[model samples]
Target: MKYRNLGGTGLIVSEIAFGTIPILSGDVPVLPDYYSPNEETAIAIMEHAFKLGCNLYDTAIVPEYGDAEIKLGRFAAHIGREKIIISDKSRYFIGDEMYDAVNRSCKNLDTYANIYFVHQVDENNEDITFGRYGAIDALNELKAEGKIKFTGVASHYYDVLLRGAKDKRVDILQGSGNILERGMLERIESEPLFKEKGFILNKSYAAGILPHFFRIETLLSGVLSYPISSVLVGMGTNEQVDQAMMMKTENYSRPSFSQVMSVLEKSFVPIPCDRCQRCRCKYGTEIHIIFRQYNYYFLGKDYWALRKLDLSINESAAQCKKCTDMSCMKKCPHEINIPETVQMIQRLVEIHIRKSLI
Candidate 1:
């Protein structure tokens, strides 16, 4: 596996990392499972990965729901405990939350994870859960006291991720930038990486749509890993582990101009609304907002936790209906047929709801 300075943290992470979300929660065959790894399976995967020189492992703990760290603790005990580097999440937790997460990570890993992250600090324009710990004031104290070796963040959006990189207190940054979540990448195109720090790129496969999976609908999904430094991936079974290890360096062939444009032309997925006004009244009407409203009215229960990402159509879509305008559709470079897509998304949401209710 190739290794890089990881944004100059003096820590050289393996290019091919074995992400442990599967060991935490087994969610999907393709998506990293969120369950804890079984004993025999854990031993097998860890052994294969280590044998191949892929040593970095990352896991996270949500206050409400997760068993990943506990399983990792057991795996660490089974293994030599100190043979690999561990990266775990500790986002936005306060006094008790920070203390509990710190203690849990140590106990679960059976050793100190070299790095602990503030998980999801900038999601939905929210303050970090570990606001107290995220600053130089607190983290410097903790580092001096040996609470954690290095501090960093795992974020979904680049606006916050970029700010985190500029903060001297923030030593590492992980973002969703696979072939699908390129939104983050586009934002950072002009800016430099966290010089002298690290940038661990996860979701390299674009969730589950990459490699060995069919194309067409899985636009956000991909099998290709970009030319980025380190790409973190998860394995649920032993066979999958082998593929991750033995996979040699990819011979990348950048697409021709037409090919690139064609791919971009075909690969646009509508941004789900979260009631945020980021789009403003630009579309001359609310497009995604309209979809979100119809979604809730039509498919309410099916969207439970998904509600966190809903976009409000009260203004945008309502404006669209009031005026003889449809500017958002024209501005959409993908030619998404915005009005139709929003309506379809609403339709799909209702269909899911109807299935569940029936």
Candidate 2:
């Protein structure tokens, strides 16, 4: 496996780092079958990743009810301390409780971590991540005292995350970006302008939705074109891991610009459902956010993001007939063709249901 320079730091992290979330709650519908993995399988997968030259592993303090960190640390211990570089985080406010959270991560990894991430950030709590009491100061203190190698943030909100990216003190940053969530991609040309700092690209599989519109080769091809130095893929099986490894090398190169454009041109627009409360969608349709559903279907098509939304538009996935046309799309900002998109999603949902059932 090839490695890239991490930010301005000399650390070389693998292109496909591992993310350990046994389960994700809220706005998400499906969880990977972490339950099916015995301790043996989990151990094997971790070992396999390392054997394949994955030097870095990322785990959270509260990884889906505590199992992930415990298991990860145990694996690290078995694998030998010198073989891996670990990164972990506390998704809490940085002050007061931050150090204790980090200590817990160190203990769980059974070794010291190289980078300690500052978890999540958004509009309401930008100060939580950027202020003196946040990860920046805390990390600086720790680094001065010889606790960790560097610091960074993992954010979900793009705007707030972009702010984090501007901070020179922040060593690394990770957030949601996928083929469907092209919003983040638009901001990437400025990546070189990060004043020489680099970010790690997560959600590369679009949380698992990119494969919908494009063929698997095409999706993986586009992923390698991202500007960030590292991209993480959560692999449950060895086949998935091997396929992901293929994205890093020159042997499996990216699709050409026209190849990308041609694939996008055939893409369908998202369904029409104004988030406005004026026209209602029955069957408990979240009239507002399903646009993300359609966007996920087309642009990024990350299954994890789609599942994260926890949206079930219809009873059987073919239930678009549950609502009449509210014409909410007519008032949208960009003059989007809304109703047609909803119908398209309805059809897609049925297809999803059928494929899953089979």
Off by over 4 Å in 2: 22-36, 63-65, 212-217, 247-290, 296-358
In lDDT terms, how accurate is model 2? 0.62
181: Cα error in model 1, Å: 2.6
Model 2 poorest 10 in a row by lDDT? 22-31
Model 1 clash tally, residue pairs: 43
Residue 355, model 1: Cα distance from true site in angstroms: 6.2
Clashes of 2: 22
For model 1 the TM-score comes to: 0.71
Q: Candidate 2 residues 1-358, lDDT tens each?
A: 7777887888888767776553222222244433335556777877887888788877777543246666777777889876787777777656556677777777766667788877776655678767878756777677666677888777765565667677877787777654444445446534555435656766656556565556655554455466666677777676666666655446445555345445656765343332222333444444445666556545654454345344565442344544456455444533554455556566665566335434
Kindly report the root-mean-square deviation of model 1 from the true structure over all alpha carbons: 6.2
TM-score of each: 0.71, 0.71
Q: In model 1, which range of ten residues has the least summed lDDT? A: 214-223
lDDT of each: 0.55, 0.62
Off by over 4 Å in 1: 25-37, 62-65, 93-96, 123-138, 193-196, 212-228, 250-316, 319-344, 347-357
